[model samples]
Target: MYPVIAGGALSAMTFPGQTAGLSVFADPLIEQLGIDRSTLSLSYLIGTLLGAAAQPAIGRLLDRFDARRIIVVIAVLFSGVLFALSFAQEIVGLTAGYVGVRMFGQGALGLAATTAVAQIVRRRRGLALGVSGAIGSAGISLAPVLLERVVSEVGIATAWRLEALAVLLVVVPIALTLPRPAPASMEVQRTSTGTIIVAGYTARQARRTGMFWVLTGALSTSAMLSTALGFHQIGLLGERGLTPLEAAANFIPQTITALAATLIVGALIDRHDPRIFVVGSMAAMAASMLLVGIVTPGILAVIYGLVLGLAGGALRGMEAAAFVRYYGLTHIGSIRGLAVSISLAASALGPYALAVGAEWAGNFSQPSAWLAIIPAGIAILAFMVPQPSPRATRPS
Candidate 1:
């Protein structure tokens, strides 16, 4: 559990997963250095994409060695890279540092950590991932205040140095406490370069099928709505008549609801059918958007954030749980990487699309609310995929 929590923490320490404004800092930095957002964004984007593209190779490596050692190296170097980002003075320097930070901070840390958590638990997989995720989110929520306080008291470069040190210190105990891995089974120890990927009908295998595409499309749609709604949450609330501070206060519901729903969804996934929970959550996402579309009340906006946060949070945690439950743990990391890469790519469309729509429509009412079909439609397609008929797909 310690390693699981820490593993997840390392992964989430990215630009977006970081305090959110780290990316915004580039704006000011760019102006001072005479660079373009497109250039910086592209550099950052390509680096992230490159890192994600490496997950399959990483997954294969995990199967071959004691992954804890690799994690240790990543943890140490990741902090060093983040520390370097703070001192970057020019656009070229900043771009180089940013690439390294995202690669270690978000790319390797996140993927490796979650993969570790998956390896450690069997019962209540959702809850395990959720608890680990919560720790990572706590890091994110705390980052804004921490960075501001530190930078003000000292300096930005100093603050980054301190933060990197703090991350290393926090992970020390996790590194010390990781369990000794058992010997690989005959199947796990296969000598030939035979494919670990199975062609048998399974959720992940089906994920490669059209049924999976349907689920992916639906989820991708909902993901887009979430991305838009999240970006404009404050603006939407302000329009509904809350003061800026009060509109900000409305995010409180999200933290509480998301935390609770994550734990509950995990426990439920272990004992019941995961698809039911998934479909229900996606349906809730649709309803939330639809409600906000028809009625722009202040309270409804709060309600929307709360429900969407819970649904989104739960879905994020359950995504792997559902896949593992329907499939199994072998090659889980590889499968999940592809799923996340696709989902994250889809989600990227949200904020950009929302910006364009908000500019044209002058509000979030129609464009924001009209995107309810994604998750709901995915839920219907998820219902179509059959569970691998032979529960005995892999040797226990």
Candidate 2:
């Protein structure tokens, strides 16, 4: 229960590095730094790509060291990075700031938070993860609104410093409060209920299996398409005849739908095959992309929001559970780390790809429609792939 609470807090804290969180300050930063939107997007692309490269190593470190300590370190560094980012006056400084926040806040801290919860809660693990994700995601969804108020009141630079302070005050203590892990030399540790064995395949062995690629593909598709849509939300919907406020209002339905879907999928994953959720998420992504190509300012826009929310929430709910269920807990960090790295890299590519596509076609519709094919193909592959047996393998 303590781990669950701490994990939820850590997850919520990741908002500082998430796309939705950063989007709040985009307009302000562009104006303050005297840069065009394209230049800012390019910086984000390079920074996120570089940040994505750090996850595999962070994941490996999580497997070898104390996650609680690692999380503490990450939170402190993340806070410092956010503070420094507030002072950036040029592209190079802004890019470096993005690298720091993305690496520490998004990549390392997020992986640690989920891995910590997944490591300790064996029985009813799905419910624990679901609750944790729900809490975190709810906070993430509300971040833009909350930060907007702060930015409006105190200005972007001070808002950033306040956010940094919040991270230090909130995240560090919760991380410290988590229960200590059993010693690494212990193969079997006794919980309050009974003894449990820590077992799972190493990262290398998991990579050799077909299920790994199937799951990764499904997860990456959601990350990429959703991120692309999010990064270009105002512009994309503007092209479809929606005002900026109307486009932004759509997030309310999307966030509500995402919260519901995340909880439902989380509860169900424990009893049902995870592949069902994987395939369903991809289908939702496909539908949303196709819908985005033709959506209007009213009902169609809301429906698009719901479908996109479903895609994002369902995938988020099931991702940790699928990895733990299929791969086991012993080496879960390293295995899931590799998958996260790929997903993050895919997310980096998404916005840039869509931006370039939009430039080529002179509108978002053509590029959005073309992107649908990727997830549609992945959905078919996920459905065709057989489910892996939940057998524990000896860690190397």
Candidate 3:
């Protein structure tokens, strides 16, 4: 219970590094810096890529050292990065700030939070992660609105500083309350339910398995498409003849549906093959993309929001639980890190790709429709792929 609460809270704190959270400040930064949207997008791309590159190393550290200590350091560093970002006067400073926030806030802290919960809660990991993911996602969905209000009241720089202060005040204390054992030294517990503790595969070994790639493909596809759609939501909806206000309001249905799906999927994932959810997520993503290509100001747009929410919510609910279920906790951090790095790298490319495609194609629809093929293909692969055996070598 402590682990779940800590994980959810920590996950919620990752908003500053998320694309949706950053999107709130986009127009303000552009106006302040005298840069165009494309230039800002480029900076985000480079920063996110560099941040993604650091996850594997961070994951290795989590595996070897005390996760609580590492999370505290990351939270403190993330707070400092937010504070520093409030002072950016040029693109270099902006990009540098993005790198720090993305690495410490999004990449490391989120990974640590989920990994911590995965380490501590083995018996009903799916339900625990589902609750955690739902809390995190709800907070993420609401952050932009709350931050926008703050920015309106206090101005951008002060809002950022306040965010920094909030993170420092909130995260460090919660992190300190977590268990102090290093992941490598923690003893595995078995219960009367015949839970066999096994040594998880190394990152290298996990990479070699077909199932790893299948899961990665599904997760990466979701990350890429979802990020792209979110990063350009206003523009894309405008292209389809919807007012900006209506477009923004569409997120309400998406959030509600996402929360519902996250809870439902989370509750059921423990008793089922997680691959089913992966396939379902991909299918929903494909449908949502197709819907985006044809969405308008009426019921179609609402339906699109609901479907997209389903895809994102289901994926989030199952991801951490799937990894832990398939791979034992022995080296879970490294394995999860490798997959997250790939997903983050994919996310980094999404907005830029969509921006380019929209520019070349004269609208968002054709590009979105074409991109749907990626997830559609991955869905088939997820359905056909065999599940990996969880019984590996015993933990050393």
Candidate 4:
């Protein structure tokens, strides 16, 4: 758990910087190199798209190989790429290196980190995963702010060099220290196909059933809204008349609130019906998005921020937890890979849709609530009480 938390925290540092990799290029490169901004974005986005599709295959391989070793090797390679990026003067080299980092570091590394947690913990998986995720959340909150300070004080090249070194030195030890002990008995390995650990369906059957639809549909819209707004919240809030400082203040508590939400929801996920947890989470998420469109005064923004933060943090953990409960450990890799793919694909559409809406309206007005409605609709649709798959337990 300690290694998981520490490694997750460090893994998150590269996200803010890599996400804006194109901007990290010198302006002279942009003008002199004739590289299209569209091409850079496409390369970055496509790498993650491929990562989503590749997750299951990676998961299946990890199941057979020494995943602990794989993670350490990948982490080392990721650090090497970051270090190499410092020397790339052309857009092609930079974009290619950035793409590699995003795919292996951000995308594949996520599967290794989170799925490894699920494999280790049986009881209180939610709480453990929640805590691990919060470590990453702390990184998300701190990375951009920290990078800004670093870049202003130093330079982008020097800061990135320092970042690569930090990852090499800090994350390597944590990754190397992950539990090497195997499951105690051969009994776990023999469970074939759809053995039910949690509910009606064996893990395999969950993949082929309608319940998966119900579950996926439940949160898609909420996901859409959250993904879109996450990129633009501070600016959106500022436009509503809040000062930049006030907008920034709202984000600080939002991170803490998200952490609290994940912890609480994780604990509840263990005890409560998944249906209740799923629907409640969706509704709370919708309310947050709606609130984002309305709150400009007093504590409404704070409260809204809290809701959004919790929704984001818990939702990721919940999706993992629910599937774990539904599917058990046998086929978790395959099912989760599919789930990650769906969510990532949908998320890809979210930002594009927001851009389209903004273009249509000439501003980002009124569309916020409308954008949120889709996820709410999904939540309502998922409430139709899916018939649990008949095998062991699984959600595909």
- Highest TM-score scorer: 3
Q: Provide the global lDDT of candidate 1 against the true structure.
A: 0.61
List, residue by residue over 1-396, the lDDT tens digit for candidate 3: 887877898999999999878988999899999999889989998999899999999888878877888888998899999999999899999999999988887789899998888777766788889898888888888899899998878877998899899888988999888765434334354646544456677788777878888888888899999999988888899888889999888888889888888889989998999989998999999998888778989999999999999998998899888887776677778888888889998999988888899899998988999999998998888868777876543443
lDDT of 1 by residue, 343-386 (tens): 54555556667666767888766765666666767778667876
TM-score of model number 1: 0.80
lDDT of 2 by residue, 158-197 (tens): 9889989999999989888888765433344354666555
* Residue 396 in model 1: lDDT: 30
- Residue 333's lDDT within candidate 1 is 56
How many pairs of residues collide in each model?
A: 3, 0, 0, 17
Off-target runs (Cα >4 Å) in candidate 3 are 180-195, 393-396
Model 2 TM-score (2 dp): 0.94
> What is residue 353's positional error in candidate 1, in angstroms?
1.6
Ranking by TM-score: 3, 2, 4, 1
